[model samples]
Target: MSYFRSVALGAAMSLAGVAGAAAQEVQERTMTLGHVVAEQFPYHTSAMFMKEKMAEETDGKWTLEVHPSGAMGGERDALDALLLGTMDFTWVHTAAMASFVPSFELFNMPFVFHSPEHIEEALSTLDFSKFYEEADAAGFKLIGIGSPAFRYPMNNIRPIETAADFEDIKMRTMGVSAHIDTYEALGSQVASTSFAELYGALQTGTVDGNENALSALNAMRFNEVQEYLTLLPTVANIAVLVMSKSTYDAMSAEEQALVDEIGKQTVEKNNSDYASMDAEALEAMKQEGLKVNEIDDLSSFVEATAPVREKYSQDLEPWVRDLMAEIQELPSAK
Candidate 1:
């Protein structure tokens, strides 16, 4: 009778342990991440990497369902969805974020960073954290910066060889104020349009020119529609990945930490991947029979936009000047 009682007690203890483990395993969370870029795009790839890492870190307790290629909607739409709690996260362009957070327009300022390394360093500074905090206050959690490829010009008109070349051309620009102001200063008519309509807009003569990173041009096959390519590095288009505060706040402390760490890792991977892809895309553009032109007088282009920058300073937050000054002081990129 004593031996039988001891056996029954051992069985009960084993069953209790199994029940506890099952309870822990049932604690799972799901999040939806949206991106405007295609699945093959670097930004989307980085998001996927983050999703995988998040799952691994939490031992499958956390999972992200990615909606790529504008499946959820455009940047603005995705942001609205996030606010409504329909979308948990998204990778939005700085220009897109400008509508929600006016202070973010500072990033669209031309020639903000001299090089990719400088851009990365400036962004990694402590001041950048303040922007994230501000985002949190505004109902979203700014995860980290995703580096889009370098900006260049593609035109159906002539190659942009000089400042005079920009005179009176109709250029399609992202629907952002700074871009409109900058192009207006350059003597071009800026038309705001969505990415989905850009190719048709270019082909149908709705616009004579457009500017974007080489990777984007290649991804969209704009070389087939545009006749000229100019290696004019105008801006470093940065993307910010954000999560809805409602979604983030609902997670446990351990899960939140995992998400934050994954965001940092994804940002670094995106930066590295973009640098390489930008070079490859530029080469591909050259081989596609597009006339590539290198401007001899870049200073003229910069000087022509002085008034625009001054106006941006007046209109934007004081933090813009502070961030710009910090970027200028950083060591040159190798």
Candidate 2:
């Protein structure tokens, strides 16, 4: 009986050691997050916030390494890396991500949101279950999304107080079909330009103008090149944080919960920060000598974009269209 008791104690000790080793291995795993935006962008702040919170909540069990300013590569490359499991995560504008996830084009609908608040309210209500299901099927996971403020036209040539101003203006775009068509429909000659060359393009007359969130515009220092900003039919932006589905699934249940909680906190912080950054950017741009004009007749721009939206809608999936309808009906914050 004494020998048997001694043997049982030895087995229990070995099992406890094995469990401790497994827990240590789980805690030592590192996650890599990549993004194309500069550190000046609020996205970077949010990413770091998420990283810190994750490390704290997990008791330093997981550490996140962030790569900003396209250090890893472009957004598209990051998405590919996520699928290949070379990158654990990436954050990118849904507009740029539309090529990989066509349903994301739903956010591109002009005049769908009035302010960041409206977009957030809709996001809080609209079911993204399908998006996750689809992303998982494609080997990517949609972890969280943030409202990226509103997009408006900024030009060097003239104030776009009216849709007529867009006539004959050459605008740089991401070369997405919907974006190109939207500008063309509104009467701008669209130029598909690289992000790295956008400032040079505006300065050298390669394109007269472009549209983006005010924060992003300032982050790129477009205020240095672009002289005029026309706040028109505001377009909303969604920044999606993506990860490899397999990578997320492989995390221990506790680790996954921590990640999810941190993701939600990141989304909230980024969106609210982006919303406030818009006003700060406007003030900064004013100080930078950019003439800003508010379009009194925003309805005109919306009317002009009607055909573009209709054309794009024709190709969108049914659920995407339904999602668009829901988003358009969300309470406005104008």
Candidate 3:
């Protein structure tokens, strides 16, 4: 009986050792997050914030290595790397995500979100949670949406005061179908171009105008080449942070929870920081002698695109409409 008791004690000791080894193994794993934005960009700041949050939550068991300023690769290349598990995470523009999950194209729909608060509320709602679940099934997991502030029109041709000013103007776009459709609906010829190529396109007259957030215009020095800033509030472009499903699944349940929590915190921080940055950029642009035109009649722009929205409604899945409705119901911060 004493021998039997000794054997039982040995078995328990072995089980405890095995558990300790497994815990140690978990602590050894590292995650690398990549992005195309410069270190000065708000997206990078948010990425850093996420890293700190995740590190604290995991108690140093997991560490995040951030690659900023397009050090890893371009948006498409980074996404491909994530799928292959060579890269663990990244913040990609929604237009870039459309290549993997076509439903993301709906995010490019102009005027879908009226304000930053609306967009944030929609993202935190149940509908977007379901959308993230679907995205996880597609081999990528949504972390959170990066704040893109308000988009405005900048052009070299002429000041855009009305929708009619868009007539015959060739505008550069992110090469997404929805954006192309929106610009075309406004009577402008849309030319799809990469952000890296935009300066040359503008200088060589390949495209006469481009739409982007105020921060991007200032960061990219578009103000140097562009003459007019049309505050049309056309869209709220989003940068979506995502992780490879395989990489995420490799994490223990506790580690997964930490990452999820960090993502939520990062979103709020990004939104608040981006809003302040945008205001500063706007002031700087005004000081630089850029003609800043605020369109009092945005109704003309919205009215002219009514048919465009109708034509594209069929292309949008029912989930998008559900998400939009939820967003509309949220309390406005504007």
Candidate 4:
């Protein structure tokens, strides 16, 4: 009996030693998160929230160093940096990501998502295993999906309430094929310009207008350069918080769990923050001399852009097509 008791005590001590070593393996480290948005924007504010939460969850062992305002570069550049291991994480909208993952073009399909709430519902309930597999193939891990709002046409030249309003209007797009095709379908002359140079382009009349989520437009102060904001929900602006797969793989399982948890929380924080910001920004912009209008006849614009959707859907995989159909069928605020 004494020999059995002695053996059990030694086994327990060995297990404790192993557990201590495992805990010691989790070293204090800070990861970098980058995005091309103003500091006051939800992208930055939510990142800061993640930063604080990460440190608390890890007991100060893990933290984040966030860079905003294009300090790291545009969305594409940031994605490249992640692939090259220079950036650990980045927040990028689906439109910018479509070039890297062709299937992502589904998210950029014109008029697919009716409203921001519809997007949120679709993302939360969708089976995205295939999307994640593609992202892994591209050497990145999608940590979270955030739909702050829908993109709308904002211009300096005139109010756009119908497809006719887009005629001969020069519009700047992210150079995504779908976006370019959509604007062309609507009869707008599409101009390709880097997002960093968009403000200057709008100010100099190089481009008459552009479309973006209200949060981004407000944060960039597009109202200062543009005259009208038409509340036509053109597309759901789906922002993904992504991390380098290599970086995520390097972390201990426990640390990865912490990062994943915080990434998800950041999404909720962003959604809440954006709702407040959008309402306040709209009211403030109106008082500051920005003309805002709502589309009375959305069917005309939808009909004009239908070709853009059909053109892109021709090459989609079966699963992607099925998912797209389901998302479109989701209930919308509109």
List TM-scores for all candidates, in order.
Answer: 0.84, 0.85, 0.82, 0.84
| Highest lDDT against the true fold, candidate | 4
lDDT of 4 by residue, 171-204 (tens): 9876777888888999999988788899999999
Number of the top TM-score candidate: 2
What are the per-model numbers of colliding residue pairs? 0, 0, 0, 0
Tell how far residue 278 is off in model 3, in angstroms. Answer: 1.6
Write the residue-wise lDDT of candidate 2 on 23-47 in tens digits.
4445666889999888867678888
Write down the lDDT of every candidate, Cα atoms only: 0.74, 0.75, 0.74, 0.79
Q: What is the TM-score (0 to 1) of candidate 4?
A: 0.84
Off by over 4 Å in 4: 1-25, 156-158, 193-206
Show pairs that collide, candidate 3.
none
Model 1 pairs in collision: none
